[model samples]
Target: MADRVTVIGWDGSPLTAAACGALGAATLVAGAAHHLALPEVPASAERIRLGSVDLAARRIAGHRGTAVVLADGDPGFFGVVRTLRGPEFGLEVEVVPAVSPVAAAFARAGMPWDDAHVVVAHPRTLRRAVNVCRAHTKVAVLTSPGAGPAELGLLMEGVHRTFVICEELGTDHEQVTVLTSDKAADHTWRDPNVVIVVGGPVGATEGGGWIAGRDPAAGPRGWTRPAQVYGGELGEGERDVLRAAQLARLGPRLGDLVWDIGCGSGAFATEAAAAGAAVIAVDLDPRSCARTEAAARRFGVQLQIVLGTAPHVLENLPEPDVVRIGGGGAAVVSAVADRRPQRIVTHAGTRDAAERVGRDLSEHGYHVECALLQSVDLDTRAWTETERSVAFLLSGELTRS
Candidate 1:
């Protein structure tokens, strides 16, 4: 058992004086092949090739002399330092870190990255990283072997994004290439890469910031919007009271996908987007799509507008955590339910329609609930004006047979 362990971070740069001294004095040194083969690491040190990091940590713990571990940049960040300090190992370790691949990638691109979201995609969870890119304006993905730039580009087909791919950062073979997501997909990318996806209106110089993505602290103050604030006919608009209840039921949050099927005037979709959910508003009527887009802009929210009939159109859209069916019939409800979203909220014009939706949801193993919502507004003349509405709010967990 060495008295203490030293972990040195290498980013293909010359080692610092402290790192050099630690490596020279180390009785046991552990690192990947590249780190072990480095000319600066003293040849006399007992080298342990890093394969299963846990096994290496155990070996370091049992060694009765000073040990040094070499890792890629900023070991504390998605690197080996977490495992070394975890309860399983619990080695009292000193860390000497270098610039992380993430920071290096952004620096090479000459972009201010404080507002960029950073996601790591190993082979198993690449889909989640891609989804984050789909939802946000800017993202940095630290890639794994099989889940490199091409795989990421495949998932970003429809998203408007520019990809800055940095391969083998801080090395002799280092190369940086900028491509569109489509272009990135068509070509084979080198390994040991970092992908930066930038979308929206971020141009050559978007200034600087201190936060990553939208500040969680600065979210929509209030989602309730009066009818007159939106464009188009109020004939198909959802009342603010009903909208509030539906928003609550949907529970839209960051990194969630919400589909507003048959979105009329885009009220529900816009409100959900305001609440930080990635929203898709689908409608058959061109007018409805226009209205939805207008409302999205009016509320300073981003919306993906799909102009088509439901069930058919929804087949190709991204999977949703929550869905609001405002205009479609029972068939539409059935179609959306088939996708197995976490929650579905639909309002109907007739009791038969509401009952049919409830039954359909019940058949899908959802706990169904129906309600008749009404509100009375105080007019300028001190008279009470009343409006009544009915909706079927359904929620269910997927029972995979």
Candidate 2:
């Protein structure tokens, strides 16, 4: 068999006798700068700092002697294990593990994590990580430099959550602090940190015995509907057709924010919530807002109901990934477009309104398209549902590199 590149996991504690034995025999060792400084590492052995892991792996692959990669927490976890052993490196390896930092963070807080969602907050993955934090009741973020605690806090603005930040776990400089997401944004955080985002106190939210992270059923629904359809801007059958078209274009999912301007019946708002995105339903009418809130409760979903007019109310709400214009005309559409939501879906009872919205959206740099949706057939037979409708839906999406 080929020689194995022994990967050792460290938890800032004294090295085990076996780890020490492996270190003593190793001819080449790789780790972060701090890990290379550990006294257990033999001075005679060549040290490789993982500033560039691929470089270190190349060196290890070329070395004609025993090689070991020292890593924090469990090497087999979201650490260096996969990189060193995968087809890119394809090196044989034996792992000597220690308590993972995530476990250490949860332990320091004295919270259980059997049902917690864990994510890595890196440059490419930070947005999704933040979205996970937003949607889940409990989440643990393995943070990176630019995507650290403060960034997470900022992204989490307008959403209520509790944050537990753990730094330098298992070391003398270790510290654990708990604060609200609002306050977390104001503070600077140390690197090599793990952040736990909790919706509320752990005890109140703990019920995950069989399933992991969030209960799949409770998280979000693949398809969403309101408890009961109230007659409003959209009629009974019309709502379903238009909603399907809007949802398909908007693609609201967990970790997205969908702003519904003049959220007439609250059906669209509830549906977006059911898809796991945070929803902010805005309208000037007190009755509309109340009905939306009621529908949210009945559907067992949540929505931030703002009882005010749009173009002005939207100023205070969090950024949205999608915007649905129900009643507001060109002004509302223009207001939502200014925020640069990835997609915008609006309706018009007339062709003039639709054409006007399409022109406004196009002027604002959106690739626009319009469709006239009408009921072409009606079931005249008694006991069969029938409908008559004609409406225009204009959809716009901003181009991004």
Candidate 3:
């Protein structure tokens, strides 16, 4: 009996005479339940249903006679072959690969997958898979029993991704459905499916050209942006004043995480996100939260928006290196002061709010600096006359005396 390992690929096809002969003489066979059900397994051979990759590897190592390990689709591409032949097992594996599910799914959809980011949405790793879909353009998610279309669809609710659910590939019951993330949530899909997330605008070309093992936008363009060009929904006149005052107070820098409280339209949050710092924008108004999300998408930066009241909402969040309170009351300012950010900036329309925030920072052992800016936009009359209205801008930065 040959004491060697043989890996085989199965695709619901009848086992060839040669394959039957090999399996009939084999001393041990290991595979999933579906693979073990194939008629090719020798009646006398010991069968091990692959429960875990580690257990399967152990069984293969202990086997003395000719052993065959069965795998689904292509074992080389995000499959079981890698785990079986790793250093711990050290067993030589002869790879017999079939058409991978990803390839089959893309083929069924009549789309090219060279640019797709392939990920496995197993129960244990679904969060990372969701994050990949959130951050990347194209993705092929290998879904497991419960991590199928509905779950993935829910995970991708807010992000812009079109789903192509390819179920039961290479089988008689094969089906493919294309839907937006919202519609996918309502539809139940079959198991052993591959979900393709089309990236970019639904009808636009995906990310243009691609590079090997590199993100589409991975190059000289590093993250982060200045406050002036943050590009919120503000009018030209309002934007000018807010941009000037925000830059003067917040003073964002590289690698720093900033919190934008009461982040209306997320202008400050977008600016900080563009600057390469992680940003979280919170607002009580649901519309504002939606607007913030839209602005972040337009700018191609990651800005998390939480729709809720501040102070209470900020309680559970991670500490920030810098905080800018665009709207909130004294309690919100005091709560932010307790976090002791390296810098704290607040825009105040009233003198009382400004004085309260300044005093709170001072009481927290910070040397508070305050500034007020008044700007007026001129309106031309029929005779080319000018009219003006002034708005107060108060900003404060806290530093240790």
| lDDT digits (tens) for residues 1-401 of candidate 1 | 77779999999999999999999899889999889998878878889999889999999888989999999888888898888887877699999999999999999999878878788888777766876776667789999887889888887666678899999898899999998888887887777889998876432223554456666544346666777777644543387777887887778886678888888888888888766677888999999899988887665566788999878888888778788888777788899889888888877666776787788888987777777776666675757665555444444445542
lDDT of 2: 0.80
Best by TM-score: 1
- The clash numbers for all candidates, in the given order, read 1, 1, 5
Tens digits of per-residue lDDT for model 3, 1-401: 22877777765566656567667777899888888887878878899998898888888887788888887788788877888888888788776667888888888889877766688888776755765665445678999987887888876655567888988886778889988877887987888789998755331224445553224354224233333443444532235565556755677654356788887766767666555455778889998788788777766656667878988988877567778777777888888888888787766666786687777778876777656666554554544435333434545455663
Runs of candidate 1 exceeding 4 Å displacement? 202-210, 217-220, 233-237, 298-300, 349-351, 369-372, 380-383, 386-390, 399-401
How do the predictions measure up, each by TM-score?
Answer: 0.88, 0.84, 0.61
Assess the local accuracy of residue 51 in candidate 1 as a C-alpha lDDT between 0 and 100.
88
User: Model 3 misses residue 324 by how many Å?
Assistant: 9.7
**How do these models rank on lDDT, best leading?**
1, 2, 3
Comparing candidate 1 with candidate 3, which one achieves the higher TM-score? 1
Task: List the lowest-lDDT window of 10 residues for candidate 2.
Answer: 219-228
- Evaluate all candidate structures by whole-model CA lDDT and list the values in order: 0.80, 0.80, 0.71
Q: Which TM-score value belongs to model 1?
A: 0.88
